[model samples]
Every structure is written in structure tokens, then in C-alpha cells.
Target: MVVHSISRYLLIILSLFLFSLVIIECKSIKFSTSLSPKSLDLKIEKLTHLHFYLQAIIGGDHPSEVKVAGPNTSFIAFGTLEVEDDNLTVSPDVNSMTIGRAQGILASADQNELAYLNVLIFEFTKGVYANSTLSLLGRNQIDVPNREIPIVGGSGVFRLSRGFAITSRIRFIPNSSVVLVFGCYVLHY
Candidate 1:
């Protein structure tokens, strides 16, 4: 009889403990609604245009881009991966006013064509947008005269930025170097 009474008391205590835990968890839980830009006092800013040249020195003693991994293949090295810290300049010349660096990885994804999967970050170091960065993730077809890549996100003055960058190969040398011009149209707030 005493054992049965003790078991009943234990069961009641356990039930009370579990109920208290559930109540505590319910009190801690927070349900929030979605907030709008107006509620946050954020205004949409003006659209901005940025033009620059990306100078990639490929095969010199001080190359800006290098193939980190790839199979021993032909000139069009498919499945190859290259990492670059190319110079973003105002002009096509390597000695032009430096704006930033296109630092990222590019992989030859398409086996049939000259298409590269580019995952790059445009890190600005000069002018009004200094210390800012814009992330770019898209496919770049080298054979195309004008390739458009989407600018995904950004920081600093370019926070919440969305845009597209038109890339055109200005100059290319066989096994030497390549210079590409980028015209970026961005909208941010």
C-alpha cells in the first residue's frame, strides 16, 4: 500500500515538472511579424553606375591569376579552377588609378564551351565607395562579346545592392594576359 502511494506521488511530481517546463518554454517563445522598410526607417537610394577595368596578368613572373587545380588538358582547359586577385582599374592600363580588386575563384564548368562559373567579390579600396564590397556570382562566357553577370549583394554604401555587370573583353594575349572592362549598374539603399 505504501509503495503504491509513493508511486502515485512520484507520478504527480513528474507531471507537475513537465507542465512547468512547458509553461516556461511557452513564455520564452517569441512570435514576431514581418517588418517593412518604412517601419525600419529605411529609404531606397538612387541607382549608381560603376565602370572599371579588370587587368589579369596570367603568365608573367607576377601573375594576378593562376590555375590552382586542373587536369593536363588542351588550351581550353575544361574542369579547371583558377583563383585571381585581379586589379580593378579606371582604365585598361595596369598603371591606371586603382579602384579595387576582383578577388575570387573561376572554374571552367562547361565542357563544350568557354564558360566559366565566376564567384567573385569586388572589394573597393578607393574613392567614395572605399572599403565596400559587392559580390558577383554568375556564368561568364568568354567567347561572347558582351557578357552580363548579376551582382548579388554588397556592403557599406552598397548595402542591399542589386544590379548587373556587363563585361567585355578589351584585350587578350595568347598565354600572356587579358584585360576586361566591366560596366556595373547598381541600385542600393
Candidate 2:
């Protein structure tokens, strides 16, 4: 009877000790304040306007765009995904001044309309913004004129870049290729 009592006391003491440990751990957790943009000394320097053309060669022997995964029904079928490394040029002509490449995946997310969820990186290889990249994530309604896409972020000279790209279909060669003009207004440091 005495041993039983002792074991009960010991179990109760261990339970209390564990509970105290948990309380101590919870009390020791320090909550930190999130750093604000101003506290980080981030300043918006300039609003730069960039104009370029994206030539997506969808067909031919060496195409820049390829359908990666999708149903066999149609190209614009919902959930269809295509990957592209389209050339960025100064003009609509593919042979114009080569500046960069728009590399990303385009997914057909709309069933009723020809809309694509574009997640692209505009990688500049020439001119003043060489070696810089701007990330774009937005919906592109192909039928709409001047479809706007948000420039979420960037790297290199385009660090902390935020902007919108006005994209318009310049030319569309049926089953061959499509040329799009992108006019971006970016605000960055």
C-alpha cells in the first residue's frame, strides 16, 4: 500500500514536471516584429519604360514553344500546358535586334475563352539592362487587346521591380507563330 502510494506520487510529480517544461518552452518563444519596407531602407528610384517584342515560334523544325502536357482535344483546352523560350526583340521582326528571351510556361486555364496563365521570366541579354530578369505572373486573355500582366519581381538591375506589361498581339501566323509586343512600365530601385 505504501509502495502504491509512492508510485502514484512519482507519476504525479513527473506529469507536473513535463507540464512545467511545456509552459517554460512556450514562455521562452519570443515573438519578433516583421521588418517594414521603410525599415529595410528600400527606396523606389525610377519608373522605367521598356518596349520589346516576343516572337513565339510555335511551329517549324526548331520551334521556341512546345506543348508539354495537355489533353488531345485542342491546343486551348483547359489545363493544357506549354513551355516556351520565345525571343525578345526590339521589333516585331524576328531578325530585329535581339535583346532577350521570355522563358516560361503558359497554361490554358480558361475553358470558355482563350486565356492563359503566364508565368514568365524576361531575361535580358543585351542593351542597358543586360543580365537582368523580370518575373511576370498574370492572366493573358489572347483575344483581348492590350492584355495586362503583372511584373511581380526581378533580379540584377531589375531587383525589387514591380510593374505591368501591356501585351498586344502584333501578328499571328496560323499554326506557325505568334508575335506579341510587350510594353512594360516598371518601378524599381
Index of the highest-lDDT prediction? 2
Off by over 4 Å in 1: 1-42, 74-76
Tens-digit lDDT string for candidate 2 (1-189) = 999999999999999999999999999998987887677577757999999999999888999999999999977889899999999999989899999999999999998999999999999999889999999999999999989999999988898899999999999997799999999999988
Residue pairs that clash (backbone atoms under 3 angstroms), model 2: none
Which regions in candidate 2 have their CA more than 4 angstroms from the true location? Answer: 1-6, 23-43
Residue 6 lDDT (model 2) = 100
Q: How well does model 1 score by local distance difference test?
A: 0.92
lDDT of each: 0.92, 0.93
TM-score of each: 0.84, 0.84
